[model samples]
Target chain A: MIWGSILGITFVVALIILYEWPKLKQGSKKEKATVVVLTGAGWLLAVLLVFFPEMPGPTDVIKAIFQPLGRYMEK
Target chain B: MIEKGRISAFQMAIMMYLVVVGTGIIFIPGITAKYAKQDMWLSPILASLAGILAVCTAFQLHKLYPKQTLIEYSVNVIGKIPGKVLGLIFLFFYIRMNAGGIRIYADFVAGSFFTETPLIVIISTMILVCAFAVHGGIEVVGRTSQFFIPLYVLFLLIIIILLLPDLDFKNLFPVMGNGLMPSIKGAITPQSWFAEFLLTAFLLPFLKDVNKGRKWGLISVFAIMFTFVVTNLVILFLMGSITASFTYPLLTASRYISIADFLQHLESIVMAIWVAGTFVKFSVVYYAIVLSTAQLLGLSNYRPLVFPLGFLTMLFSIWGVANETESSSYNSTIFPFFSLVVQTLIPLLLLLVAFLRKKSGRRKPN
Candidate 1:
């Protein structure tokens, strides 16, 4: 099941790259690098999430940082 | 420069209206009712001050740096490293912010209607559609918003007008029975929604009629404020004290519309409003994110970054939000403060610094 999810993620990432890579070929090297880096980062995060779904996420950090102010809204 | 397409201030206004009112009307009435009770309708009026302030700050900053988005001008206002850091902070804030929005949208769909559909499917489908809009740039987004506003407004009024018979005017009594504090407290949540007007900082640079930006922005704020006031009153009149009990009071209120049992199940109108408004909202924010990311990275083109960022947003929406309760708690509690600091306070500070620096520069030349 986990491998299936990973494969699914990989397939989607591949399709995005495949569809865009041809267009990126005409753009600057920097733009192409950015596309690779961003998609690669997303792919890594997806795989990591598949493995460790319990890992803390951005909302957790935001909640922690803002909890002091957020407390007033709590019932 | 990255965005070749230009939108008018009126289009910008329409987009901003949807951005605030899209999910806001659905989620906010219940939350505001929790505090404001009978005075929930008043919260949006008071909260609109934040929208005005945000528009003013963004407009003033645009006057100083007329050609650049917030990400680019922050560098000019605050020096390179700090400005870049600020840009990244904004980028992070927006990405997470849009994620929460899309999540709220998915949760609404899945929880209220599509009980059997997978959340990932809903989230991804919405993201995919928004990606096309963002990929089309500001022109596409602006035109789409222009096309949809009338329909959106019509559907909204249809629900309210249909519910007129069921409304009880007495629910508005004891208007301030608990005094203004409860309404003020309720205003806090909606204030964050209003603070989202700071997003105009991005669209302002791409505007064709830059001079009309502030006027249209204020008009948009007033429109959203009016919409919220009307919806809140309608919900308040219909449900009164029990308004906070339902997760989506407006949705429930719309579900109540039954004229001769023929105009029944009008909640689909609410669903239409949600889906369409959220698409524009997400596309606008999504465009901002992609454009700013390209600027921050000094890329020549933003198009390639669109899909990747959309993918990231999808992942982020599903990231920390384990369930509807957690997401709502975050929205009501943490999100308001977080949004205020990032969206409202930070831009105001940047504007002040930009003005001071410009003054000192003029004095040095003299």
Candidate 2:
């Protein structure tokens, strides 16, 4: 059920992007197709990051550096 | 005036207040509780005094050059090269601050409500929205803040009122238990946030009624101080000693609100309101950084630098501190001195130089 909803939302978002891209590209020649593809890829990554829930990359690094402060306050 | 936009002193004041009070209301109570314990509310009063001193410095500089921004007048006050260097430093600080705010808000949302959402998505979406607002220029940003400040205040009042049932006034008693030093130390972090009012030096020149600038500035400071006091008292009353343990005391307080089960999980609502305020705050700081950079570089337009700098800001925010703990430590230990030097001392020096220059008849090329 959750995966279905996620996929449905992604499809709708892609359709909206497709509808908006041409209008947004009317004045610019900076690879409209490329920008659209990249944006779609970004949305996909966002969805994966949400669903996968990895061990934490950037956030954990931050937490590790500040662990001393946290420990100090805990004391 | 170099800029075409004109905001009323009232709008300018509200914008300043929104910027200063943004994320502080959420996280500060926790940090204050950690150090000051029951005396957390008093820290804001001290912080506000520091804010007032910083504002005076900014105002003096503004008075010296009535219609120029800090970027423009710094050149007149401290020679061209040094002025540009100082402007760049200010620009970098504002950019980093804005990015950090974005990250913090993103982290808050991810931790509290949208547990499934990626932090980068939350951060990027908010920054993109702020970038769009920044593209609209100062007038749009000012008007948006005017619209949100009242809503933010109303939400805060509602939260305070709801938590009234949970509040134990006794929790705030035995003030200054560890003597004045801890509270004063707690005040340092907020004073840095308050010293951000010096950004008003950029916005004041664009105010329609410059004479009302001082009144509005002071009002903004009071509003911010009131916000901090209310937030601290509520957190202290409700959470007591454990207040320091939570990452966001205000959010925790909202979560503690359980009126017949229907009002139980209003954390999402609070998050929405906070995100709105953070939006305005981010836009203001980002806009100031871009404007100052453009002015310093003698650019014909600031529009081009906006997106590039936004990207850099996002990167720097991610790289700025190792974690929330480091961020909080920086906020508490070092930020006060940082703010005092950048927002207070430099502006005072500029004001003095401008005053001396005027006395020597070096006023502008006229």
| Candidate 2 CAPRI assessment class | incorrect
Per-residue lDDT over A1-75 for candidate 2, one digit per residue giving the tens place of the 0 to 100 score: 668747864774565466545555453444344334444544554455446545244434434655554444434
Task: Give the Å error, residue A34, model 1.
Answer: 0.9
Q: lDDT tens digits, residues B25-60, model 1?
A: 778998999989999999999999999999999999
- Candidate 2 residue-wise lDDT, B1-366, digit = tens: 336888999998888887887877766777777778889999999989867876677777788888888889888888889988888778766766676677777777777778898666787678778878887889999999988987888888888899998788788778887799888767767877888888888898888998888888898899899989978888898988888788788887888899988877777778878888889999989889878876876755555445556655655565536556656665555455656667777777777778888877755566
Extract clashing residue pairs from model 1. none
Candidate 2 wrong stretches, greater than 4 Å: A1-75, B362-366
Q: What lDDT score is found at residue A14 in candidate 1?
A: 99
lDDT of 2: 0.75
Residue B268 Cα positional deviation in candidate 2, in Å, after optimal superposition: 1.3
The 10-residue segment with the lowest total lDDT in model 1 chain B: B254-263
Model 2 vs. true fold: TM? 0.82
| Candidate 1 Cα outliers beyond 4 Å, as residue runs | none
Residue pair clashes in candidate 2: A62-B322, A62-B323
